[model samples]
Target: MSKFAKAGVAKKVMDEARKPQNQQKIKSAISNFTNKNKGGGTGAKPR
Candidate 1:
């Protein structure tokens, strides 16, 4: 997946992690996926 997908997944995961019905795995995995690939990749690269 791309960096954007990573960020999006992180947000959704964190939101789910806040709920009590969610598993502890979600909470633990939060730190693993969140902010790991944040950067200015949203723009086109200069070639």
Candidate 2:
């Protein structure tokens, strides 16, 4: 897409993310994602 179209999309996203309800939803979604991935391990095996 063109720069103008990209700018419009970015503006719309920023507008949505600025709302209190959307902000709470975003925070919860991020926290849930992190909570689910907290037990990740490295690829190396134990010696």
lDDT of each: 0.75, 0.91
Across 1-47, the per-residue lDDT of candidate 1 in tens digits comes to 99999999999978987887686676567766664545458656869
Instruction: Tell me how candidate 2 scores on lDDT.
Output: 0.91
Clashing pairs in 1: none
Best-fitting candidate, scored by lDDT: 2
Off by over 4 Å in 2: 40-47
TM-score of each: 0.42, 0.76
Which residue pairs collide, candidate 2? none
**RMSD, candidate 1, Å:** 11.8
Q: How many residue pairs clash in each candidate?
A: 0, 0
